[model samples]
Target: MRPDLRAHALHWHDKTRATQMEFGLWQVWEAGWVTAILRGASITILVGLVSMAAGLVIGIVCGLIKWARIFPLSLLVDAYTSLVRGVPELLIIYLLFFSSVEFVTKVVTAFGYAGVAESGYAFVIAVIAIGAISGAYSTEVVRGALGAIPNGHIEAARALGLSGGRIFRRIIAPQMLRIAVPGINNVWQTTIKDTALVSVVGLQELMRISFIGANSTRHPFIFYLIAAVVYLAITLVSQAGFDAIERLLRVRTRK
Candidate 1:
């Protein structure tokens, strides 16, 4: 039978006893579920923020390589971005989760270290996997943004005897950011949603916690609803934050 139906069945039983039990369950849920959701939210936000930051750093480096017209290196970056974009995100997560420890152990052994890989290594692997996915998308976003900058500005900077680094820092970076804000916002949303996939690897983010709660309480509908609500709340708040950031940037640019 469906778990929701079963819950309804139990709730519909002898009035007084059912009422008492339901009230107690409600109280427990109010207290414990709130705590669980808060903890899960913290984990999810941390993972999203950290992964996005890591991805941005990696992506900028790769994007610069791709943009620099160093034929072989650009080709390699293109291949990497294409492979990541073409493959399933879940497959990436699984591969990283299962292979990370062995890879770390091998590297450590090669360096003459003796201890086994630590359990916390899974968290690092999760971050890498998610960050890699985000980086792939970010690379394209940054590359496109860089391309959108007018060629005349770069030539003018060059004419002014500005070095490459100074040209990029002073002339290219701000314009690229202005053009890339919307794309980066989309990447951030994608990263937030993608964090849910880490649940399959036993990371106790929001979805994983919801799965546990549903299984333990046998109230799948309730728990799933709660999870959906929590995710929606996160998305809404993040969207607002991004909007505020965009507005602030626009004001500063105007000034």
Candidate 2:
């Protein structure tokens, strides 16, 4: 064989070996590490679901404050929403993970509770970080939905002698939710993806487990690929669920 051809053959052989090695690693992962992957997946889902719910509550309150036209209160809520949304989600997670315990300690201390700082719960940190980031986006979504509600609806409610709270509860809140669902769905997906970032703080979330498996097995590509697939699966499932919800809401509204 020609020298060049021989060298080319050797190079291709080396590449093939690397590829096989990577594949072998993935095969091992598939064989036994599926449970760990599932555990991580559960954590990811829990964090996302909890954060989304907390975010919705925070967002709704902020959104209402914005709608209320109370200048100082509205400004405070606007500032909070802007600050949270403006910062990178990863940074927010990092700050929350590091400082949350201390902050909680101080609050507890102020209330005359001692030694609460020693109990640094990973789940709580993840929830707070995810919720804070999700709430920022939720606030805007809810605010836009509120704005989208027809002014005539409020006027009609007032014309019927409905009090402010009753008008909002009966007429405005439902419409706002209908309009907000699509936007909130986007935030929900974003929050799910954002949970991966929390893994950097030692959260045993899906990505973190993937990283551990990869490092332990010394097969970065294989484990990372699995992680990506899991994340994709999550996104797909969540998207389908949200679509169903949107459809249900639409039908209910139409009726």
Candidate 2, lDDT over the whole model: 0.85
Task: Report lDDT (CA) for all predictions.
Answer: 0.83, 0.85
Give the alpha carbon lDDT tens digit for every residue of 1-255 in model 2: 999999999999999988888676666666687888889999999999999999999999888888776789998988888898788888887777677666767776777766353343667888988898888889889889999999999999999999999998999988998899889989988998898888877778899988888787777777788888988999998889889988998999999
> Which pairs of residues have clashing backbones in candidate 2?
none
Q: Which candidate number has the best lDDT?
A: 2
Q: RMSD (Cα, Å) of candidate 1? A: 5.4
The per-residue C-alpha lDDT of model 1 at residue 254 equals 92
Q: How many backbone overlaps does candidate 2 show? A: 0
Deviation (Å) of 110 in candidate 1 = 17
Range of the 10 consecutive residues with the lowest summed lDDT in candidate 1: 114-123
> Pairing residues by index, what is the TM-score of model 2?
0.85
- Alpha carbon lDDT of residue 223, candidate 1? 73
